[model samples]
Target chain A: MTTSKNTDMDPTAEPEEAAIAPETQPREVATIEQRAAAAGERGAAAVADAIEQGEDAEKAVGVLYLGIDLGTSRTSVSASNGQRETIASYVGYPKDAVSQKLLKKRVLFGQEALDKRLALNFFRPLEHGVLKSSEEGTPEYEDNLRAAKDLISEVIRRAKPRKDELIYAVIGVPAQVSINNKQAVLDAARESVDSVMLCSEPFSVAYGLDMLDDVLVIDIGAGTTDLCRMHGTMPEDADQITITFAGDYIDNKLAEYIRETYPEAQFSIEMIRKIKERYASVADEVDKVVVDLPVNGKPTSFDLTDGLRAACQTIVGPMVDGLSTLVSTFDPEFQDRLKNRVLLAGGGSQIKGLDLAIEREMATRLGGGKVMRCEEPMYGGAGGALKVAHDMPAEFWEKLK
Target chain B: MTEMTTAKAPAASALSVAQMLHLMRMEVDNAKLHGYAICCLMIGLDEFQTQAEREARRWLMPAIFSELKAITFQQHIRGLGLTREHFILAVFPHIGVKQATELSEELLAKARELELPGITGGTPVTISVGVGHNSHPRSDELETLIEDAETGLNLARSGGGDRWMQWRTVEDELEDIRGELDEQIREMRELGPGEESDAVASWGHALVRKIVDAFAVVEPSASLNQVRSDVLAIVSSEVDRWRDLATIRQLSEREKTIDLLERRITKLTGSLDQTESELKRIASLKAIDTGISSIYSTVQGLLDGEDNTEAKREMLKDIFEANLALRQ
Candidate 1:
């Protein structure tokens, strides 16, 4: 199943060595012919299993598995067909006939929708890593529901599933998402795939890296930061923590700082979001973050280095607090182990020197701790979900279908 | 009856006079298509008092033809041939009435310079030329133009043998107005930028007044209200057509922007796909565990192994149970 042996590294090794060890591991020595032969055998075995379960031979020939991380700011997918894709969580419809004719499309997705938002009825369907509207049958709810369905279809289409293949997907959502929201997600995905499942975002990140035991996963997403503690079994609600101090929180903070310091500096939330993504850091020393903002219709440069650092630093305290809660609540014997094997992941974790900053915070608050950033923070959740999809038994998929 | 023999004219270059006339007809038609003027000149020798004098002049005809051909070539005119024993015809295309008149006079002067041998003494040959000019010839006007030149030739011969005359028609007077109008339009176009609007306005007012005056004169019975309405309708339609053209230009600009956006989107999408593939390749190179293989198989394989089997089984069971609850 391609389990990650990163957690099996020496406990006494330097944190840097431990972090770099996983990437420098020697590749498996299987030849192309050997891998192909093994894959063929697996395919045959799956076919036999499917046939034994009373499925048609044609349906058993191919199955396309997908793992999806449905985040508030972005949606990502990892497909068994060696396809990976991510897009901004935006969808739009042309506002009028003129716009429709000019755009030559009835609907637009992601950045295209965002770019031509003035001519479109734009919707960002998810907030706090869940469907924005929970009240069923409302216009807003229906609109968000439709947008989410279209987004799921788009992400699935990007996977390029063949016509002959049966599609099974596992989606990773926020750890503490309500039942109704999970159902909403399931409802959206059902229209696009034959079978689907939902799992916690932090759990998926941990499982993707094979850190299922005595590891703490902090998935810092745009809408919410999910911290889930794994102890060799499925994490219940008690094992998870969700916080609002994530990417969007940083953007709002930075915007507030800019408004207070440079009152005349004109900027939109979208611009602030882009600026935060580009220059976000919690470190003391960072390059001067000079950004151009229009004042009286003219571009003016404003140095936002301190304001940005302050904004980015805001998420760290809440994140470590969540970590501290998970660590304190764990068994006494494994409390230090959980703190040492912390896995920092998701889009918000891409902030420069974030792991070290979190480690520093942990040292001050919890004596000493290690924070390891996942190599592909943006894709970690999706990759883990895909692994879950692949590992799911055929009967479970069939029953879901 | 004596049989008439077809004589090849020196200007016709071995072609019979009939063939030369056919070629002239074709050239006239071509000139009409291009809105060019065609001028026909008919030159005849002065009347001979005696048969012996006429015979002597007849022998000098080829030399006279050669001199006229040289003059035509020098003036860049072509399509010259002999139509009768006493007459030489020359066709010039793209020449205006004034230029053709000058050329006819030149031909007459050049012909008078020739001295031929006579019974009494060396007498200078005298000739008269008739010019027919059509500034905008129609395809069927070739025969009429030739007849007009013939009439002028007869008139010249009747008046004086050594003079030249032009056959003018009502069209020639209209040609003056056409030339003036074209010049005014060109001048208006060439006016300085700031002066253009005023010039165009004045020109438009004059044109509208001219049209109203023409309607009043041409249709005395028509009501003034009807005429005013007709003029208004014409102006409105022209304005509407210009407005439509402007709208089309705006639409075209918008379409270009749309096309640019579509191209940018396609390029970005391609680059994104490439980056994803590259990341995957890098992951594979680093032997990063993607966990793509099925865990069901992994669990079954681990059943015989002794490496954390109980914990692995319990973890798998937990994942299954959670997924089951979600699906249900």
Candidate 2:
């Protein structure tokens, strides 16, 4: 494929033909809002400033398209107004009047909430691609729903959309999410955006890369590992497998083993999660995993190399097991092709040597296989969802609105 | 709180309205950049028009203005100016219209106690102050802001000079409304979908729609629905495909056992080797560790047809079947 950048007008070109070309575009003021949306971080202050520069202060026109990946552990967004941000899937509300006054906020989000967790009633709204409290008509469920909505809105606002601009967004959820959960996601988004749509997370990843044929996308999320087979079409449920032995499971397993080895060691799930994120590998040889934890109120270093590796390796069994099933059942003619194009995505795929480990596992059990990790694991789903939003026809967007 | 800075006392002594405008602009600009509100106060000396009062004005005005400035300075008011017969003050850094009203009330009370020299207690230099906050003051909008403050001063003078009055410009009022709407939107988001009372939620929905319409967003929901329907259609087709595939049972009963036998043998041998190594290490080093290493480095659960491994195939089939059932 040849890449072309148009610089000048060809006077002799056929007028009608050139008019229909996808390369052609209409000229406009190229306002700061447009440029910011294109660049992606344009926030409220920036929008306020941009609107001040408009020729007509009363009317500034723009559209901000957002693609959101609402994961269990982290929420990510890519906006047309050139903003991209990710925050932990955590929400916090001040415990009482004193804390509220001290914090100077009624509700806190993302890292701010995590840092000030002691004064907050913390809630993580998502679990396994849906609201943790997705049940009907309960206070806890309502509270969690609120948290999810706030988190979604916070991520969207992080894009810094102009109040004058239309916001249309597409969100990616787990491929097999229930209709009710999908409805909840849609409802949450409706308040924050003009129109919204939902797509399968793994499919969005595939769509983002334009890899629609004979490809296997294994998205290892915090709560689940989703394996989707793309054979030049929308993958059916039979072609996708979701297993729960993912990032969170690895964290818990690592914590369990560490406790067994160092009974007196003081640690938290949060601490273990950080350690895993920093140094998770399933390889036989790894750098020395030395970490310090309090034991009897004294900090001590422990050699947890084996424990970490063992914990990281636990997911390998279930993932490969699922991969093997998807591969064997595919059309026999394209089975080899599918085996050769395993694309690893999601936060869990960030584990060092994971692709290699999966590859090795595939070869030993399934004749031969290849595994490749996404370049930007954390943003892959969001990027894909954005692509889906971009490629979706105008009619689809209109119908949703 | 009578701690007026000696340095600023000279500036307010004979400051012109033009000089006051320039200084007020700088202070307002700084406050705007830091997201703080600043209020402009226009105070008029009530009975300075009579010939006798005019003769006493020069000495009486400075003393009264100086006293007022001194009183405001103690309250941490940031700027002060005197323009002809009008005394102006800019109080800043988060002092909104509400706080500005309170400051005006306090100033009026203090002005009544100021005993003008050569006048005894004859009217006591009762002054009226008009207060206006520089709301949403863009660079060009500062001139309008000063006019709005002046209008407030005129209102107080007409309503009888002994009282304090405050007014916000129309633009400032709109900005306040916008701020309130934004805050409401934030609260609505915090409430989540379907959790808020229906009436409030409905209003939020309508507000969001109006906002979207104002932006002229082209709706893409129909296409979005189309894409969703396509995904659902694929699901239906695949289900039909699975039904066709399910009817065929390829592997023989004998083949399934052999596959299971191979796995059991591999597992037992690996465990035996691991036990031997652990024992040797403990005997030699006297280490008291009980960490069990996993046996298979790579997954051996797939059916590699060369070994006629039926059990692994069965496992894959079972998993696939379970997934299919779940989808159904």
Candidate 3:
């Protein structure tokens, strides 16, 4: 793992640097390669320790490690050792002279690559509920795959898996990724990871939460909206549906509407996104405030009370309608109970009035039920992956990515 | 400034004057994207190059500085360094991307030549100049005049390239853009004697009257765009068969339902319960598509064709299949 570029700084670390933390003040003519070799050794030691912990069979420590939250908007990865994270499911490039010089680069990804957003070109890797890909000969082809690869690679880098450990990653694919899409994700992940196993994102969330018995998991993020009905066993395809309208949909609609009303305002794909995250509210607010909007070269404030209210409430109706449909798919005996337990996860679930809004709409549909938000914000998916790793054998784990 | 004059000259490079304008617009737009405000435009001229038949140029080739300096004799004028943030130099590759490069000195000389207010020159004035804001944010017409020096230099040279030119204060030129947009909107209101009238705008004036007389409420998904589309085949064909067309009234009703559906969509994003409702809705809609198409078409065929009981019975079976699929 010691890259050629690293040895010129540590010529003599090649011999004595093999020991722990002893590379400092060694040979006079050290080359970069020797230093790089030292770095690789340290990396190897960390992996050995992580792998040892993963192999633990006792209740306190299980060597099997995992990370997953197959998301509607984006997928997140976490390991048993508490490393890794979320990857934005988008990729794009600058289009024209304006965009080319401004970005100073060709392509961008995740939150960064929103296409030629600066009046140039832009593309999203996942549109609606499926992979956003086109025929290889088409112009839109390589971009989406490139983004997915970049995202997976970034997640693996975050996990910091070691060379010797039997690295296994069980990634949660969208319930809608289709068998074909799941296979594609696994193939894409093959390069950065040792092995791959695909699981339904929603079910993975429920299993992570230990709510497999009579529960529902709704993972809402920037990309898509997903609902999973969980029973004692792994949920089936009939139990899930990925909706196109999620956080981004609302943001875009708001942006379109706002642009017409305030034509001079300089609205961006990012600022509006941050604004949605910051102040988008559905439930009745205690403190109503006007947001200052940048219009034409100046700042203009508008009473966003009604606009925010309407925009935030946009997803509520579809969610309720979907929930009502999902409940009927449950066992006849648990129909009423399923109505009582709803679990909301993912970033969009963090909206202030989200649970209350959901519960209100649901109560009208199902007579009454409790809509619950997950406590963990960033780690639920990773936590779930870790849980899976703890029980499964290392070899089985290696099959998942 | 009567009718403006542009001396049409074949461009000295592939990047024509229009291309330069577009490029500047793009750059400004890009800079604005990074949240930067650029409120000025500046151009400089190299008059000596304009005069000589074998025009020698400076500001680009530094390795042959002695050769470049020979062409720039009016080096008597000394100056201050223009800041980078306020400046963007668009000279040839002979100069390169960096101002520190060799070919950059000619542009640098011209920029430095212009002191705080202005710079004076002798009769050897070689390059015709134009100075105006090429749509840079902070410019008005006066600043645009400064920018117009490039255009003037081109016009002076009969549309050849401009030398050192700078856009003066553009407080006035920006009004032309605003005025243009304002005129467009005003024209949209049907102000002129000969301008074409817009029905959408003309009819919208009497708000309450327009509502009372409203005849069409277009459907959300049903549009002229849906005419040749296969996605609407069943829906459109059913309309043809049953004569239960998607008329203005039904379209209005559909629009209302669609609006209602959007609210439910918003509600559904936060809760899982709405999933069932959505599925049910889709199922019902799909059923409606099948029924309205197959049943109406089948009955119409039976009535128009054999006009027999047996044909009607077969039609009933077809209707049954469509109904069963929808109900499930």
Candidate 4:
């Protein structure tokens, strides 16, 4: 039984002794046992009081479940309290007191940070859907870890959980995040939540939509595209594939094409990314995508329709190749079922006519197949995580906490 | 005399004024929800109040309506007949004030070229046009748009007709008030101490009256509310600046206590980090008394689920085992 009250630390205890006492000191062990017993008694008393008052025990212990999709580019959260929010995966600290006063903030997140980067010590803590560094104790790692913690805290704040409600969060990480990176994410989230858990991003999406059987979910994120095969049970390592051919890849390719096609047109990766988000399509015919770029410091319109489409098309082949591997390796009888029920999701999945494009590619290579886009691609992972948090047994959450 | 009706019009028929207003309301609601621009134009004949035969007026109305529709059809504008000589045109989803004004001018020019049989030879039928637009429509702004178009129409009619006018917005009125206030404040500062107080008092009264007059034109909105709060905040801040020395000294002492408490909390938090394991144990125990409980208490509770109950239970079990292993 978890109590709402936090255990206090003895201020006079030496840090070195505190760190090493758990292993060597019987007295310390006895103290821990005594505290745990006291906590158990308190929990029992709370539940008994609630029962005596004829109130639901669970309602008396208010808990808000949160499902978070911590992506390389954006972090989204869906709360049991019916709040949903997403912020860009960027954290910025003002460079100095002057910058802080000018910005009127100690730290900024998301687009505001990007817009005011000149005065900010900016950090995008995640790369390739995992913490950028795995080595412990290095200054770079510590800074990034701090940024990740702050980013998580800001996102949870946006979820607007009631102060009286305990926060139980389930964060969706990339399918193949290393154990160390997973630990780092847990460490970051634990600071902001009472209980936290990690699940694979693609699995959460599939679970959220209840398409668990013979469904292949392709989550196209900013840093990686994760393909997971769901077969009515938990997915194993063999069931998930990740590729770097994703949103950032398309932005880079579009930037390359623009530089090649219009030598004088000046554009940044940010500008190219904005254009890709607005006009990314792999269809045969699309509306003309004319974007303005600086030419000799003058704004000039350049036609990027073909370049943008071509750049977007670059991902389809790799995606289908990954899909081919998943389908070919599956049991022969369910391979077709898997192929026909492909689900496209995530921010990159919002590309115009991507489902049809994926279907067309599948038809060419694997006879014929159908692909469906999630209704809310951006919220799918977080929403699924929320569902997982909700359905998780109370005991499991207690143990995790 | 014309009767107002609120029903769908035939392919060649225009909507009645009442019907148009209803449709405009719906369109304005959509625009507000979707964050788009919409414009309305009020068009009326300039100086054609001759007691023309009722037959002549009736004959002239549809022909003029069809011509106006033709001029606007390429732009997907909708028209409503207010009277035999007056009509309203609505352009929506993306049209703004400038575009609506241009459309009004185009309609006026096209109306001048019409050769009706009932009219005297070689004398063109000139029309007055008024345009109003909202780039970001809100629930309260629909009526403002209509009133603006009506006001512009009246202005055009009074200016000898055959012209288009756009009504000034409340924002424009607010800008004027701001300008006047700035000037008055500067003048008051230049006055002697005694005169300055009198001037400030008079200026404050005038400023409140001006704000009241400007805001009375439209219903209170978020932006207007923000302005009101800003004014209140400035006044409060000024009052605080002039507080007595004793009260200010007491507030300073309280602030110092607050700072000390904050620093103590920070120090306590630093020590709390040393007892991470102890805190974890407490947290795990705390979970025993769930603050907000999950919908289900145990795995068996999922048995009655309508779909995929078995699969969900297995998945839940798998997730729990994985998480348990990680926690360990």
Residue-level lDDT of model 4, residues B14-115, one tens digit each, is 443335456557777777778777776666776666666333444444554555556556677654333322444443546777777777787777777765
Give the interface RMSD of each candidate.
Answer: 29.3, 27.0, 29.2, 22.5
- Residue B107 lDDT in model 2? 71
Say which prediction, candidate 2 or candidate 4, comes out ahead on DockQ.
Answer: 4
- Summarize candidate 2's per-residue lDDT along A1-401 as a digit string, tens digits: 00111111111221111011010011222445544564456444455665686643323345556779999988888765456688889899988643453354778887678777876899989998688874767998888889999899888877666666667677988878787777778777888987677877898788767677889999988877888998765677898888888889999999999889889899999999999989998887889999999898899999989999999999998888998999999889989999999999999998888888888888899988988888778778888776555545455456567
| Global local distance difference test of model 1 | 0.73
lDDT-best of 2 and 4:
4
lDDT of all the models against the reference? 0.73, 0.67, 0.49, 0.72
Q: Which runs of model 3 end up more than 4 angstroms from their true locations? A: A1-75, A92-108, A111-122, A134-137, A163-165, A256-266, A397-401, B1-328
Alpha-carbon shift of residue A360 in model 3 (angstroms): 1.7
Q: Which lDDT tens digits does candidate 3 get at residues B1-328?
A: 0011011211223443234545445544554466433322232333443433112222211112222223222333211111111122232111112221222335344333322111123222222223333234444222232334333333333334333333232224334444554554454455233212233223334442443344235443566345425434544454344333334445566567656655554444433334335435534742342100000000011122322335333423332332233223
TM-score of the candidate numbered 3? 0.47
Ten-residue region with minimum lDDT total, candidate 2 chain A? A15-24
Q: What would the per-residue lDDT of candidate 3 be over residues A1-401, giving only the tens digit for each residue? A: 00010111111111111111111112121332433344477644543564466533111111223465544355566654444456555555666533443344455545555422444345555555455665543556556656666667656654554433444556765667655455456556677765555556666566567677678888776777788887665566778877766888888877876777667778686778777878877878645746777777688886656666677788988888888889976778998888878999877887788899899988887887888888764455556654443433333333232
For model 4 the TM-score comes to: 0.53
Report fnat, model 1.
Answer: 0.06
Quote each prediction's TM-score. Answer: 0.52, 0.51, 0.47, 0.53
Docking class of 1: incorrect
RMSD to true structure for each model, in Å: 35.8, 36.6, 35.0, 27.6
Against the true structure, candidate 4 has what lDDT?
0.72
